[model samples]
Target: MTKRHQLALATALVAALALGASGCSDTKKGSAGGGAGGVNPAAANDGLTIGGTPAKGGTLTVLSNQDFAHLDPARNWVMPTMDFGTRLLYRTLVTFKAEPGKGGSELVPDLATDLGTPSNGGRTWTFTLKEGLKYEDGTAIKAADIKYNVERSFAPDLTGGPDYAAQYLAGTEGYKGPLQGKHLDSVKTPDDRTIVFELKRPVAEFSATTTLPTFAPVPQAQEKGPLYDARPFSSGPYKIESYDRDKKLVLVRNEHWDPKTDSVRKAYPDKFVVVMGLKGGQIDDRIIAGEGADASTVEWANMRPESAPKVLPKPEIKKRLLAESQGCTTMLNLNNSRAPFNDPKVREAMQYAVDKEAVVTAGGGPALTEVATSYLPPALAGGKQSDPLKIAPAGDPAKAKELLKAAGKEGLKVTFSVSTGDKGRAEAIQQGLARAGVEVVIDTVDPGAYYDVIGDLSTTPDMSLSGWCPDYPSGSTWLPFVFDGRTIKPKGNQGNNSQFRDDATMKRIDEINAMADAKEANQAWRDLDVAIMAKSPSVPLFLERKPLLVGPNIAGAFGHPVWVGQIDYATVGLKDPAKSQG
Candidate 1:
């Protein structure tokens, strides 16, 4: 929605905040719940997970309640966007290792021969493409095709895509886009294999930005602009065989892609299929029972809370569930732009009024979540658990009422906007605050459009349910988006949703951003995370462990938190469809 990144999209934290696109929901509808195996042996879910080697062949079905928000490589930035499902069809200059946890540090060459050679005081970066690259259509993948991928992202038509390269690349400042014929002189396609980028400044870690799927190469002839989502040309192991937008998508093997050239994906699944529009309970039940093709199905997010009670208890079901830390922090946005919340005392009172226990129960209890004391989750460096409120993990209503009286808002009425799927969560908050003399009017929207509505400052309720996923693996992703006033926007990846505007805090953020030293940066961000909680702009609710049910039919069922707990698409495959239990 705003400048930041797909990463800024949130990458649905770009359309991954803008990524903040669609989160906290996944595939669904069911009669009952419980996994086929039930006894999951997942270890932090990430730190100790071992899925054993997977066998090849059979279709891997991705069932979802909703459709991907964007597919244009440039426009798709949210965390839960179709990057995971469609990644096998595309290749970026640089990509993350297929590992389930902490993928940011696992940068590896995809199309590029190596990371990137920086010269001219790190202002210029160059990458040489690997030989024998070809699109699904059997055409040689040229460096110009890669260059076009970045250039078209700058087109005004391509709004919501990452502009980091456009903004930072030298000789391109004030360059609007390529639709009107203005091209970035800094990006040079010197040959069929070599691509060079001249930056506006000395950026030591520019290689990280290339890891984004937004940099995925596209052939100019197949470029569909706005309609690219219909079916993008493939450069990876799979190609879109048929696409029905929100309804269904089928991927067949891209015979032209040589497995020897790529190192990450095994390309085991001969076909990948996505069936959307099913409700949560429906999908969970099928997966749990290992019925029909459900054995091949997997959820994009977690098993819905509606199915939580039915699934979390069964010992056998726990075996197939993925309960890993996803570096995501779910928080209640206190819209300071509105009344009651505009008052700091009122915000703090509401924070105290929140019963973490009740909220966590509504969020499927500790089996799938851990109460977050600070906004920083343990997934990031220097993120230690600290309860600033110091009240019980449950909450302190008496203290809250006392604060309410202190603030002269003894009987405040605040409207909370939440997703329809999260109705229990809203009711939980309403009940918690009632004791503190606060009335919460529930406002529920469709889960798919939740962020868009919340981002609109004018229509946004006094309080809203939203979350942040680490774009990369750093506090820089959390602190800046949650507290940095400079990042606040009217719509699209609206960071600082609380409308918090404190000069001292903003200054501290500037200082933190400028700190080049790793230790100093980490400490500065840790300090900032603590300081933000002191303001109580928003309540840090919980850190999530994606308790998704992976069908026994699939061999690699580990959930990848980097993509908002979606399975690592490339690595997962069927164990043995022929010998599968259904």
Candidate 2:
């Protein structure tokens, strides 16, 4: 079985076992609207404004988790937090529109006016740059800069660039050569405004690559040293004024930025501040005391009605909450390459023992029923409320016992590995699995050691709890990384740490990948879910919902799965005129 298949099975099992819990109302409230009290339609408008007016010039103070680990986008593959930092310092050729739709938000031109079609049989792509664009230091952004960024992303030493680049751009004549230390064949800069890309094979999702930060243009002059890390010099609406590492991040308006030309309207606050390291309860207390920070990202459980008084004024503060469908799915990854889990029946039996709903309820919040049916979440696959993938697993101890007996592994002793960070959820999982007659031991480890040990297939654990945050909103990402045969650690090893591999399932995955349209892709993803359900590799846990708290003074603060940490610093503004003047 491929790593993808194992991940899929693990996801399914976690979902099945975690099926016995519930919580708050799951209503279809649209993307978070802006306002002081109640949804403000105008505040959510794309044409940005500060304190209801287009005001530029002011330092926005932001509190983040930590200083970005890497300044270079190519070497960084984490989500919006890291992406947010890079975006301030760089700009992508194309970016998803800041709206909701079938494509979530279709790819629209960012640095480029429009993405050109391939000149030769969909093998070559041409990009025409917008006129008068400049780097932060006043140097013109040119085709050469874009070319350099692309080539650098695929450089031999940079292992952090999205692995998909190697698969998609590898065929581009010059691009393939660079992969093996040979000169690139497909990348070329014809003029200052024009750049072209040649691929070895026709890929329908090629445009998607342009949305990645690695494809964002970088000035050749600033390529050397730790310049990118110092502060942002990109053409974005806001520039990084200062970065104080753990304390704060300050963003100032770019006077050179033209609001009309730029899709985002500049609503620079006098100061936007992010207060980091505060617990959810502490945030509530501070808000109640009228000492709460300007903006913050809080876990969903922390945003209960009880905590509202602390965060919001009794009569005036309005809460606008937006729940984005995350590409992430929490699950228990079993080391199939090891004992106990090496028996397929033992792994399958555990699936029958888990109660997912209970876990969701314990997490505190709404009863999110769209549990993990596959490695990919339902939202990405365009799943409806009535979708079969939403079905919960029937917890049957008898069936689990029978499955264990069938595999001649009646009494299996296994240690369940989970990180200390997930104390509440992991303990619940350990307790739930014990009902299946398995001697499940709970092994807790630090966050760093947890990830390091799990990734090492040679040192596989019996069962481990893991979660996946998608690189993008795509099933291809979830499937291949977790289950693809090629991703396995050792040769001929299917990377199915659960030691569960199925030839038939791998064939189905190929079919899913071949589908061209969204509808086809959605159906293929559902079918893949069903296949994974039958073969349990790991158990799916609950889908996570992150809740955020914003001060009443802050406006235009919205949430997105892509924008995790920062709350759109460029647009968010303080309502108080006094605070606006800071």
Candidate 3:
């Protein structure tokens, strides 16, 4: 289970969901203009703009709702830190190209000179460093540093780090982490510049996985057990000047970093001061007010959902509000382990009874979400309204009634386990299903521990609200987490809340994963999304979006295609137009 980001209801209210999300992708309509594999035309970015000359030499104050805890590059999975902090300082072997606006996030080489070359059917891979790379301290970086940094992350203390290497590297399964002196022999340092990885199996999405700073080089001499998070060494444009725990953080230019050595980052702001510990509402108000330094500040945390109606109508305020898919598909997971839900007809009936628009409205409305029909967000190439049951998001209570009657379970008592915070949406679902004569009972769980309560197969509730944000930009992230029965586990972040353990589905996922080309693999996964949805195991509610607010004096702000919708922190600079002209 990925540790998961939280900010909104449970795991999302604290963190943004769009990691490799879409741009101007369709939000309202499902599967329009010719059927299979067809996506409607792209949507206009809701007041989102990108690409401008960045003026330097001012402090960019970030007004955020959340405080970042992870500092060790390996442990950075949270959105605010991953997008705004670690990504600026820790250069990965590969990173997303900094193209602004729609469809801009493409994987490109960062520390390495090019995308890795795969051999032996992608089981073995190699990356060669570009000449001359230095850390913040001007120490020369070596392949051994990358190997050690990757290997040491397996240490128990480094538990929450990205696990791509552990999952894909050959012969690393049973080995203890670096604390126990367990080296991943599969990762070879044949020379100072070249590093090789021997994988247990062909991992098609390995390049995407490398974008995580988990593969960033760490000097063995500077292993400051727990203190590293506060003052991590910089390999990118910024270096830590000072960090006051949960209070204030200031990032200054890393003198050792040269613009010629890096292509992705703009390194615009002379300094970045991240002010922590403002209530969500307070931060939201400050962004709109734009007072003094607040004019230059941007909140990576989303705007208040309560403010949606107020700010929505005002055209001036609307320009600064960016509402885009954050690469997560929020859905209702129908637990297959339960009795009534175990019946296929019952599951199909439930799927037909769902009113996606109503659910999206209850959750936050179009201001914060796009309705979802398939498991994947529609912004992706394969994501279409290819529900396997052919169930439209618009409720079909008569069809649901017919299905329920055919199943010999007319007027069945269907109990749902939903988040207490989502009572309005649950009631919407309950009301819609009630139209079909299905008695929908709402069992509410605490928002903070909803996944825990519902995820427990022991006390498994009939249905629970859940979501899946891809770890990387691939169908492998979206589909496998929810459908691959083999990946399901108790007390873990299992998106397969339905407890669906299908050997056939797992086999198909494996077959698709084995393919090397991304387009082919993603297309296969997209088709699989439709096939799986046809089964009606889980009902997708909406594609999640965060209505992020941008401040006035901030420049070069655009959503990095992969890091959800966080304004590109590296390129963004603080300079009032009046001041910059002088």
Q: Which structure among the candidates has the greatest lDDT?
A: 3
Which 10 consecutive positions of candidate 2 have the poorest summed lDDT?
27-36
Q: Model 2: what TM-score?
A: 0.78
How many clashes does the backbone of model 1 have? 59
- Summarize candidate 1's per-residue lDDT along 516-559 as a digit string, tens digits: 44456667777777787888889887665555677767777666
- Kindly report which residue stretches of model 2 are placed more than 4 angstroms away from their true locations once superposed: 1-59, 100-104, 115-123, 155-161, 171-183, 225-227, 264-267, 270-325, 365-370, 383-394, 490-523, 564-566
Per-residue lDDT for 136 in model 1?
Answer: 90
Model 1, position 415: C-alpha lDDT score: 84
Model 1 vs. true fold: TM: 0.82
The TM-scores, one per candidate, come to 0.82, 0.78, 0.91
Per TM-score, the best of the predicted structures is: 3
Distance (Å) between predicted and true CA of 468, model 3?
0.4
TM-score of 3: 0.91
Better of 1 and 3 by lDDT: 3
What is the alpha-carbon lDDT for the whole of candidate 2?
0.52
List where candidate 3 sits over 4 angstroms from the true fold: 1-47, 382-390, 577-582
Clashes of each: 59, 47, 17
